[model samples]
Target: EDQVTQSPEALRLQEGESSSLNCSYTVSGLRGLFWYRQDPGKGPEFLFTLYSAGEEKEKERLKATLTKKESFLHITAPKPEDSATYLCAVQRGSNDYKLSFGAGTTVTVRA
Candidate 1:
């Protein structure tokens, strides 16, 4: 079984403040780690996919990094628009269609 754990269920940030979110996991066969952003009452939006340790992806103010046991989402100088629920998921090597997800970290950025 694959398990994922995310820290600090909620976060509050001021506009332009930077912080990092953590996602830790343990799985039988690792395939890929995924990051997503979801707004209230909306579906999750794709952010990044990491296939191996040391892999990283970035877009605008967000950076996603992966390691053997964990992944991190770094937000740089986030704006109010960046406030959302950040989700972490894992795709097992055995199944390409199924993903195990963490509870997610909700961020609120105030201007």
Candidate 2:
């Protein structure tokens, strides 16, 4: 079965702290990896799309990278406004866009 798991469950980062969260997954066949940021009571905002192994994408203080069986989201100098849930999702193509997602890593960036 294809599944995703994120570590730390939660993270506390100082305004200038830089850290990375982990999302490990196992899929029958990997098609794509996606990274999204979701705020409380809001839909997820697309951040990056990784189509193959060794691919990466970035935005502002966020960077996303993908491997064969896992993906990572690195946050550099996170700010209070960056506090949100980081979600990782994967699609196997056999199914629809109902991406299977990790529980998410809740990050709180303190000012």
What are the TM-scores, per candidate, against the unseen true structure? 0.96, 0.94
The residue ranges of model 2 lying beyond 4 angstroms of the native Cα positions read 95-98
Give the alpha-carbon lDDT of every model.
0.94, 0.90
Over all chains combined, what TM-score does candidate 2 have?
0.94
Model 2 lDDT-worst window of ten: 90-99
Model 2 per-residue lDDT at 21: 93
Give one digit per residue, the lDDT tens place, for model 2 in 21-86. Answer: 999998767788888899999999998889899998889999998888788899998999999999
lDDT of 1 at 62: 97
Q: Could you give candidate 1's per-residue lDDT for residues 11-32 as a string of tens digits?
A: 9999999999999999878889
Among the numbered candidates, top lDDT falls to: 1
Q: Candidate 1: misplaced stretches above 4 Å? A: 95-97
What lDDT is obtained when candidate 2 is compared to the true structure?
Answer: 0.90
| Model 1 RMSD in angstroms | 1.0
Clashing pairs in 1: none
Task: Indicate the worst ten consecutive residues by lDDT in candidate 1.
Answer: 90-99
Q: lDDT value for candidate 1?
A: 0.94
